[model samples]
Target: MPKDQLLRLQALEAAERRMKIWTIPLQTPNNRGAFLRRFIERVSDRNLHTAVPAQNQSAVQKAAQFYQSCSLVYTTGGERELSTVRRLLADFGVFWPRLSNASNLLRICFAMSAVLDWAPVILFSLARPGHIVVTPAPFYAFLLGRRRAMLSSSNDGREYKSYFSHMVDTFRRQEPSSDVLSYYELLAMESQIVPALQQAYTAADGGIIKNGTLDDILNLAGEAIPRSKWDDELGKNFKSAIPNDTTALRFVIENVFFFAEFFALMDNLSESQLAYYVGWTAVQGLSLFTKPAVINFYYPSRSQALQGHVMACGALSHHYMGLAFYANYIREEFSAHELADVIALVNHVRKFFREGFSSSGALKEFIDKSQQSLDQNAPFPSAASAPLSFVTDSQEGQLNELFRHFPDQKPSIFDNIQSVAVARRMTRADTRAANFRWNGKVRLYYLTDDKRFELLPTALEPPFYSAEAPPAVKYGALGAEIGDAMAALVSMWLRDADENTRAKVYTEALCRHNRPVIPVETATTQVPSWPNISRRELAERVVSLNAAFRAFLDATDGGNQYRLDGYESLTGKRMFFIIWCMAQCGASYGKQKCHDPLRLFRYFARAFECKVGSVMSTIRECT
Candidate 1:
C-alpha cells in the first residue's frame, strides 16, 4: 500500500479510538446506593479527561492536541455577525447550523486545549427572551484569537482569512449591549416622543387641538431612564452606524413590547404601588446574593427548607453536583421499562401533534398549520434524541467518577463562583475542541434551544411520571407539560399568512365574550391596557384544551378514551382532570395572578363551576 494511504488509515482509526474515550460505563445495576458510594470515591480534579483506557493513555493524550490548533468564537444577536464566530469554529471542522436573522443561537465551545483546561463551558448570551443588559467586555476579550486550523491542507484559506480580518474590525469597540439600548430608549425618550406624536396628530387634523394637548393630558413615562445619561449610553451603537437605520431597533421594539407596556402602567400606580413594584423586583434579583436577609424578611410562616437562605445555597450546590446524583436518582426513581414507557408516550404525543392532535372543529384549521410549523422549523433541522432514560439499567458510574463536590464552608461563596467561572471556561474550550458534532445524545439538564428538547431525570418525579403510573396519570401530569412544549414548537411552524388567519379566528372566538362585564373589569384594573380585553380567558381555554386532549386523544370523536381508575370515586375523565388541577394548585395565587389583570384562575372554579357559558369548565365539551 502507498505510505500516504497507510498514514490516512491510521489517522482515521486514531480518531475512532478517541471518540470511545468520550463515553464510559456508569452506574451499577440494582445497587444504586453502592454505586453512588463508589462513584463519589472516584471524584477528582479532572473529570471528562479520564475517558481514555490505561493502555491507550499516551495515544489519547497525544490526540487531545488536536484541540490546540483551533480557535473558538462567539458574538451575540446584538452583534448581528454570526459569520465572525461561524468562520472561527469552521476552521476546526465544527460547522454551526444556519440561523435566520430572527433566530438566536446558544453556542458553547468546550475547550480541550492544554493551556486552558479549566475553561469548561464557554457560552454565548443574546438579547433574546428575558435577557438583561450586562457589560460586553468579557465577550469582547473572548473573541480575540485566530481559529483556523494550523495545517488544514485545505483547498483555499485566503477567503477564511479575509472573513476573520473583517470580523476583528467588527468586534473592536463593538458594544454588546447596543441591542438592549434600542429597546429601552423609546421609554426614556417618551416625554419628547409623546409630545411629538400629539403634535403630529394635531397637525394632521388641521390644528384641531392646540399646543400638543390631547384633551389636556400631559403624558410621559418612567423616571427619565434612571438618570439623564440615556442618550450617551443608548447612542453608543444604536441607529448611528447606518444613520437612521431602524431595522434592528424595530425588531427589538417588536420583541420586547411588553417591557414598555409595563412602564406605561406606572401612570396608574400610586407612590406605594410604585415602591412595591420597584422594591420587590430589586429584592428578587438581589436575593440570591443576600439570601439570609430575604428569608428573614419574609414572615415566620414562610420558614420552609426551600424558603431560607440555606435552601437557596443548597439548590445551587445541588446543581453543581447534579451529575453525581443523576445515577442514584435514576436507580431510585427510574427503570428501563418506565423510561421506555415515557419515550413511547413522548413519541405518541409527537405523533398526535403531527396529526394536529386529531382535531375537528373551528380550531382544527389552526392546529393543522401549527403542526406544519412544528415539522419544518427552519434555519436548522430538528431531530429528537433520548435525553432521558427510565432507570432499568446501570453498568458502573462513569461521568460522576470524575466529579468532586465542593467542600462545605471551605471556599467562600465568591471563591466557589470564581472556581465555577474557571471550570466553565475550560469546559467550553473542550467542547469547542471536540467541535459541535451532535452524536445524537444530550446532557440531562440544559437550557432549551429552538432545535431540540432535553428531558431530565427529575422529570420522572411524582405528578409528572412514575413506573407504576397509569397512562392517564402520566398524561395528566408530565404528559401535559411535554405536550404543551410540543405545541409551542408547532406554533413556530406557522407561516406568516397562516398566523394572521389564525389570529382572525381567535379574534372572532373572543368576540363572543365581549359582554358588558369587560369594561367594568378594565376600570378596576391597574395597568394602561392594550386592547384584547375579552381574551382574558384564553389562558384558561389553553389549559382546558390540554386537559381535553389528555383525557381522550381525539375529543371531537372520542377516538382514544382513558378508562376510569376510580380515583376519588371519580371516573377516568374526572380523575385525570383532578390530578392535573391538583398539580397546578400548589402555586401561590399571587404568582398566578401577578402581571395578569385577569385574576389567577381558580382551578376548581374552572373545572367545576361551569361559569355562565365559559369553556374552562369540564362541562364545556371540546366541540
Candidate 2:
C-alpha cells in the first residue's frame, strides 16, 4: 500500500478508538428491551415466590402469560404450530394447492381478510370520516427482495431466490397435492409484480386519485375486480360505519396505478396459480411463528445470533401486543423527576429559539407564526403525569381488551397472533378515528397535524437525560436534542416560505469557513465522499447548536464548576461540547459527517482553543 493510504488507515483506526469512548451509553445490551424483561421477571417472582393481591395482579399476569405463550411459539416452532396456521388460513377460506372455485373478487377479499391484521398482502384501506385511503401493503418488500435495488445486484437476487425456493419447498413438503408450483415460476411473477408495485408507490404524484368513488376504482381496475363484488366486500368489512343508504362516501386511491397493475396481473393468473400466490402470502405472514427451519430460512444466522430469546420475544411481544406492553412498560419504568427535568430542558430550548428568531430579520414572521401554531396546540400529556394518556392510549386499550377474551393458555402461537389480528379488525374504526400516531421509541418527533412536539418516554432515561446529571450534562445531551427538534421546525417553515424569504434567511444565516487541505485519501477515509448537507440544512444546524450552547451557559450561570474530574484540563464549555458530541457519536460512528455542524460553527475548535487555520479550526467550506 501507498504511504498516504497507510496513514489514512491509521487515522481511521484512531478515530474508531476515540468514538468508542463516546458511544458507551449505546453499548448497553437491549436497552429498549430492559423494561419488558424487568416486568417479566417481576411477574415471575410474584407467581413463584410471593403472593400479590389478586386485583392488582390480573393485568400484569395476563400480559406475562400472553408474552410467554408468544415466546414459546417463536422459540419452539414445530409441526403443531404449522398445522394451527393452516387451520387459521382455512378459516379465512384460503386452501393451499387448490382454492374453491370462488370468484376472483371473493377470493381476494378472503385472502386479504386472512392476513388483514398480520400483513396487507396487496392493499389495505384506512377509513376517514367520509372517505377511505387505500394503498399498497408493505409486506411485498418483506416477501420479495426490494427488487429495484436487489435485482441490480445479481448475486443478492440469486441468494434471495435460493432462500425463497428453499422456503417454498419446505411448505410444499407438508402438502399431499402434486400441483405445487415451481419456485422459479413464482420468482418470475414476483420480479414483474414487485417493480410495478415499487413504481406505482414511488411515482411523482404517488398515483393518487383524490375524491374518487367506488365506481372510479372499478374503472381503474377494469374487469379484474368488479364494482358489485368490491362494494359487497367493503360493506361486509365496514358494516354500519359506512352506510348503505349514503352515496356521499368518497375514496382516495393512494396509488391507483398499483391497483390497475395488480388487478391486471391477478386477472392473468388461473385460479390454481392465484390460490397458490395467495397461499404463499399467508405463509409469509405466518413464517415468523412457524418452524425454526422456515423462520431461519430468510433471516441469516448472524442476525439471529445478536439477540437472545428473551430480547427477541420481548421485541415480538411489543409488536403484536403493543398497547398492553407499552402501557405496562410505561407504568413500571417511567420516572417523574426525569420527565420534569426533560420538560424543563425542552422549555429552555424553546425559549432560546423564540429569542433567536425574534431578531432573525426576514425569517422572524414565518418562524413566529409556526411557533404560535405549536403553542396553540398544547404538548402531549407527560407520560409521568398520566401514563395511559399518550395519543393512542384509548384506542390501544380497546384493542388490547379484545385479548382478555382469549383463554388463559392458547394452544399455539399462531392462534394468539390470529386472535390479535381479529381484535385489530374489530377496532379498525377506532384506528380510522385517530388523527395522531404515537411511537414510543427513544426519539423526539414533531406531529404536523397536532402541531406539537412529543418526546418518547424512553428518551428520558440514562445517557440521554437523568435528574442526577449535572446541568451541563443535561443541556449537552437532552438540550441539544431539543435544539435539533426546534431546528427541524424552523426547516419546515423555511420549506413552506416563499422563495425570496427563504433566500433571505439563507443569506443572513450563512457562515463562511475555510476548508483545510488534507491528503485526499485521508479526507475520504471515513466515508466515500463528504455528506451532502444542503446550504439551508447547514445554516439551521449552526443556529440550533449555538442556541443550545448559549442555553447551557445561561443554565450553568457562566461557571466552570461542572468540569469533569478525570479531564481536569477541559473547561466547562469544553465538557459541554464533549458530552453533546458523545450523545450524537453512536449514529455517526466511522462517519466524519456528524462533526460537520460543530466544525462549521468552530465551537469545537473554540472549546479546545485549536490553532487558527489548523485542520480542526478551518475544515468544512461553509455553514
Candidate 3:
C-alpha cells in the first residue's frame, strides 16, 4: 500500500479512540464480500426478485417464446455453475450465444435487470431507514478502515473486531470505491459517514436501527437537505415535517442491497466477468489514488496546482477560496483609478437602485441600507434576494472577514475537502463576520425573494467592459446587464405581494411608469409562462418592465441625457434600447421546449418597424 493510504488508515484508527463519540468496526480490505452475505440483501426492485405481475406477465411470456431457441448458454461453457446461471438469464429473455466470455454475458444481464428494476431501487434508497449506502458494489475497504478504528463497546468489541476483520479479508478479494459520481466528470467521492448514520438510525438505548432524521442523514454525508427530498406534495416544494408512519413514509431498508438495478445490465457476464465490472468501477472510483498522469488521461487540465491561475480564480470565486482570488483579479486588472472608479460605479448603481429613477418610491424591498461589492472577478456568481445579509458592506474588510478560518493548506484532495467542511461549519458559526455563498447552505446561490445584488468586476473588462469603450458598446453589454438587474429588482420588489397581486404589481409598475406600453397582444403564439402569469399577461408584463427602464433611458442621452438621435445614425434612445435588447440574448432548448422570450421585448418590434400585432408588437395590455 502507498504511504498515504497506509497512514490514512492508521490515523483513522488512532483518532477513533481519542474521540468520545461512537465509532464503527475497523474497515479492512480483507472483509469486502462478507457484508454482502450478512445483508438481508433484498432490493425493492420488482424484476430482480419478483415474478412478472399478471398485468405484464402476458407481454413478458409472449416475448419469452420467440427467443427460446437461442439457448441460455453455449454447450462449450464451464459446467460447474453454467446450468443455474443460464436458467436465471433465460427467464428474463437474456439468451446468450453458446460462444462468449462469462463476465461479459453477465454484464448484459445486469443491465437488463437494472432497466426493469430502477424505480423500486431508487425508492428504496430515497425512503429507506437502515444502512442506505449507495454504490455499485460492496464497500469492504471501508469496513476494514472501520474495524481498524476499533470502536469500544463492553460486549460487542470482541465480536465486532472478529467480524470486522473477517469482512475486511473478504473485501480485499474484491472491493469497491466508497462512492462514485458518474457526473460526466469522474470524481471519486469520499465521505465521512457511518458514524452519522449510526447515530441517526441506531437507538441510543440499544434497540433496533429503524429511524432517523432526514436532515441528519444528509448532513452526515456532507450534503445539504434540499426541501424537495422529503416532499409529500408535487415533489418540488418543500415540506416542513417528516411523517414516521406508513402513509407519510414508504420504503424500509433493513439491510444493504446492491441497487443492482443500475448494474443489472452486467448480468450477461460470467462471475469473473462480473468482478471486472466492479473492478472497473473501483478503478474509476479510485483513479485519484493512481498517478495524476494516468488520471489526467481521463480528465485533462481539470485540477490545478493549489495556487495557480485557475485555482486562484476558483478560490476567488468559491467561498472557500474567499477574497484571495478577488484580490488576485484586482491586482491584475485594477489600477488605482480603476479601483476607485469601480467602487464609485458600484455606489453609483446602488444609489440609482436605492433612490428611484423618476422618484425613489418605486422599489420598497426590505433590504440593507447599503450592499457591499466584492467584484466577482470572473464569470460572476448570482446573489440572493436577502443579498448577503451576512457580509459586511465593504470590499476590503469583508475579504479579510471572509477568509478568517479558511484553512491554509496546500491544495490536495484531502485538504480541500477539510477546508470546505470547516468553511461550511463556519457559515453557521461566524455568519456575522462576512457573507460566504458557496458553503453548504440554502438550495440556490442567487435567490429572487429579497432585495440583494453582488458586483461583477469582470463585467468592467473588455470586450464586455472597457473604460474607454463607446457608450453604445458599454451599454450594449454591461450597461444592459445593469438595466436587466434593475428589471429583476422591479420583479423582486413585487414578490412580497400575493402571487397574483405580484404579477399585477410588475405589470402595473411597468405600465405605471407610462414610458410606452407595447399595446397588448391581439393574437397569440406560444409564449412560455412567466412563473404565475398567463401568456397575455407576460407580454404586458415585459412591456411594463421596460416602461420603468424607459423612463431611466429617457432621462439620459448617450448615458448623459436622453436624445432622440443617439450617436450618429442611432439615437441615444435607440442605443439604450438596442443595448438592452442585445444584452438579454440567450436561451435554452431542451426536451422539445424552447424558452427564449427576449424576442418578445418591444425593442425588437420597434426596431423592426412592426406596426402592431406583429411578433414583437403586442396589442394586449397586462390588465
> Who wins the lDDT comparison?
2
Candidate 3 C-alpha error for residue 183, in Å? 14
lDDT scores for all predictions? 0.32, 0.55, 0.32
Model 1 misplaced stretches (Cα beyond 4 Å): 1-307, 318-332, 354-411, 425-458, 494-499, 504-568, 586-623
Task: Kindly provide the TM-score of model 2 when superposed on the true structure, using C-alpha atoms.
Answer: 0.67
Query: What local lDDT score does residue 29 receive in model 1, on the 0 to 100 scale?
Result: 22
Q: By TM-score, who's the top model here?
A: 2
State how far residue 271 of model 3 sits from its true place (Å): 22
lDDT of 1 by residue, 317-375 (tens): 32233343234434444555766777666665555544433444434554555444333
Off by over 4 Å in 3: 1-292, 299-319, 339-407, 411-416, 419-450, 490-493, 509-578, 585-604, 620-623
Per-residue lDDT of model 2, residues 485-596, tens digit only: 6666676667667888887776555544323444223432232233256667666666677668878878878735433434567676876776676666434231242465
Model 3: lowest-lDDT 10 consecutive positions? 39-48
